[model samples]
Target: MPDLYSRRSFIAGVITAGMLSTATGYLLTRRTPVTLTLVTGGDATGGRSLLINLWNRFNPDVRLDVLTVNSSTRDQYDKFAGTRADIYNLDVIHIPRFAARGRIAPIDPPDGITLLAPVQRVSQVEEGSARLWAVPLNTDVGMLYRRITDKRATDAEPEIGRLVADRTQVRQLAAQLATEGSTTDEAFVINVLEQALAQDRTILDERGVVSTSLGQWQRALAPLAAALRDNRIVAVAGEEKTNAAFQERNLRYMRNWPVWFPAIDREERDKKPGTAAIRLGRLPIGVLGGQGLAVAEDTGYRDEAEAVIHFLTGMPAQKLLATYGFAPTASEAYNDPEVKAAMPHLEIVRSAVEDAHPRPMSAGYADFAQVFRQHTYDYLYRGVQLTDGFVEGMQGALR
Candidate 1:
């Protein structure tokens, strides 16, 4: 059977290209130009850089009036739910929730819109349905970076054998090796130990929700607390601070978004080339993510809008993006020799993408992430009991 994306693309090409652009289509094409209102985060210039490039390259005859909204994530979601913006940069999961609410326009899969292939599989929209509500732009995935120096130290035959067999044993040896104090100076670091805990199978229910089973929580959370208590982790600061710490050599193995890792490696390498040790790995069983593109339901020039989207996601653009530090969503990019050379660790990210678990799709998902971050921070940093914090947040979302 053709995959969902291939099938949808065939259907869309046949219907949209043949039907929408018939002789009658010229009637609509010649009218006053329609402008697309794009609301995204960051400065308008930088925010729409990708789309603007596509617009310039494709020149769909439709004027794109990009509106880069400078607002907090929470503020943006509030505005979107209030039916304030026509198009916004949103997480993949939130698309379904908003679609279900009818606040945003339907993102019908058929016709001209270019939705990300991966997203189509997870989207709640029906197969062969022309109306699509959301699409992914750039996907983010979690990565495990370990200290190359530490990895080297443990390469001796005796240590290598032990490290490969069990992750727990590896971490324990790392913690001990880190304590030995060497002039080389490195430490194995990860996000607050709780992140590792969350990755364990015991913590998630069959539906992929956080499991409420008390036994599961204990089994998972215990090692995490111990890792934290043992100081194997650098304090779980937010992303900015965490990156800063890594650059400063305060961390060894850390969990970070793949997009930022190369930049981090570069910055460190420039200052201490071949000195600041670095290695990347697929996230261990958790912390997976990916990004894709979608067209707006409210885009007046649907054909033009899709033209721009398709050009952006097309093979050429995707290949270009891979050069600029982005992990390509298209599967083919992984095997490209040039892409592999530029990003040697691309396969690790590919594996991460393959296993990527999207965030929750509830209408309340954005709000849920806000609460979830708090729960993680409170337990990891603020000393709040893990169970109480997680339960409170989940219950609030359920409510």
Candidate 2:
């Protein structure tokens, strides 16, 4: 398997070679049909490849090229922004920012495209406007995964927020678990830093404008820092780390989507039998994120692209994608019995999608996102005051 550096180099070469060949004389001699490159982030590459294969069955003339970008959210944004790629497999939360940059073309509703209403509703650019910068592909919602045998797993199910609220209760539990030989290197894994800022209620103003204000973000980070400090939760950076801890029975609770559960199940089955049994619940009031597909602004075959997008989002394609363990972005798939059976978490994802909030929508919002990640870690893990650390970072980035 290719490592990160090699994959990046390969992707860069693919993009560069295509562009450079067109600039020179290679296009004239090349016998292959015109290729449409779709740049995407996230781990649905397998599902996307399947979708591309299905698309080729209809339009064999146009080849679809899939480029997998960075796995890290921040790195992925930088990679997408640095290159002038054709299509972006964007996270729904990131679409507003991409639109604000005018970096991509919008899918006009007047064109009579076959976009799913729920997909559109979740990613609507403006009310009654069909012009969308992106379309929903696979759903992903943040979920809280706790140990099945945790103290909170008594007769009554406890609300996750209430459990994480009181510092003493959390500390006492951690101490008891430690004394009882259940101590682990990492107690809890939470995406505290990322979710806090992006999921802030105050990030959006009354008129639906995105705010990157330091004060607003400072307030957001407070609860997160308190959780980490008092709850003894170790901050985790990515899905893999969170999954690893959960599978090892090291994590009492962690933030993740439905995708991680199955992978963890398999890993635990192979490594530790009992660890396979884990509990899932809704994200505590603030975690939301999902992925979507978008037509490249530069594709020559708009009509074909429209048809392909439509077909991929339709019932058949959604069912296939869901079978591969992806969250269906289409309502048809979300409502399907088979799809729901395959992914029981669809209900949770559905609620998250309907109530989901997009991240900051500024043209320079990617930059703002970076600041959110940086200052959040600084204040939450490094013991910097939420206000002082966050305010300085935001003022510098926004300026």
Candidate 3:
């Protein structure tokens, strides 16, 4: 078996090389009569290969050409658009924006099978709105990965804001926070959103606007602000730097998405007799992170694209991906024996996804994210807590 680095390189190469490619799991064959493109982020779980192969075998004439790009990069969104791909595996955060721009067409997914609560909510034009824009391929639930020495017991469930300030629980006060500067620090906003939710704050009112009194808003933000001020969570330069820090042994707790799970699973699977292990646990709330399948607005193959969506989201495809450790949007994946074996902490992931919430839904989500992050940066760092102006700006963006 390839070591971690080689495996990652192979994942990067993906389906781009086509039939003759010698990449580990992904293989290709003669070009089909009608080939549809599936553009998505770097799926580290290697689940896509299983799904793609299954798809090609089952739907022989219509093959999927998988293109995996670094969606986390700030400028990559255009690349996905330029592809004019048939099937876009869209990040949940981008759904509203994509839908509003007419970049992706809204389609009702297959009915009967239940999706995770948050997954169903996020499939809409905006949360609480009826238009269905996408069908979840798989789901993501962010987790806190802690590198423990001496076989430290996993908390399983942690009160994040309290954990940030609790010296006894966090023996070392340093954490590589996802917060760098405000721009594109979606995770920073997500972290605070999770913190605010933990404090029982209703982030948005019935009409879906930032709805908190000045005092209530400040109180909702207090724990995270205090933790940052006290240096319990150290703001790193960027996601890359933060992720690099997660590999080091000095840090106790790290916050990240499930894409990094393969590394932890590899470590546990390949550990030497005397080596230590990293364990994951439930974060207070995971602002739902994952992609859903949407048909590109310009696709000529709408029926075929919709069929592909139904096929991938169907139980068999979902289960294949789940067995490889992609978080299953369908609740039943939790009961699959192979999936359980692949992900030892499936319950932790299950719980995180269960308690998760979507980020404020708006077609102008980028604008909303910017406004929220700007004020949130002020709140977390400068201690400015007025929120009246912040609320006004968010309402403006939402409109």
Each model's lDDT comes to: 0.49, 0.52, 0.66
User: What lDDT tens digits, residue by residue, belong to model 1 across residues 17-69?
Assistant: 33222313322243566666666655321313653544543344565566655
Tens-place lDDT per residue, model 3, 1-399, is 135435444533332232222222223333546889888878655667756666676565677888876655233456677775898888787777778778988887665457777788878765666457989888886677766555565445455667765755433322334464443467666666666766754764322345546677777778777777776675564544655555543566666666566665465446633336656777666677777899999998887788778767766566556545577787776776645544557767888887787776666776777787789888788888755888778777778
> In what order do the candidates fall by TM-score, top score first?
3, 2, 1
lDDT of 2 by residue, 1-399 (tens): 124224334433443333332223211222456666678764544656756655554455565667767545545566776765556778664676666666666664323234444456546678777666666666665566655533343634344445555565342111101111111211111244334423465564322244556666666656656767775554444455556555554555666666666555444445654443455666434334556666666667565455545555555655565555566666666676645554565676666545544444444544665565555556666787556555555555545
Candidate 1 weakest ten by summed lDDT: 179-188
TM-score of 3: 0.78
RMSD of each: 9.9, 10.3, 6.1
Order of candidate numbers by lDDT, starting with the best: 3, 2, 1
TM for every model, in the order presented, reads 0.71, 0.71, 0.78
Specify the poorest-scoring 10-residue window by lDDT in model 3. Answer: 18-27
What RMSD value applies to candidate 3? Answer: 6.1
Q: What is the lDDT of residue 339 in candidate 3?
A: 55
Best by TM-score: 3
Which 10 consecutive positions of candidate 2 have the poorest summed lDDT? 173-182
Clashes of 2: 0
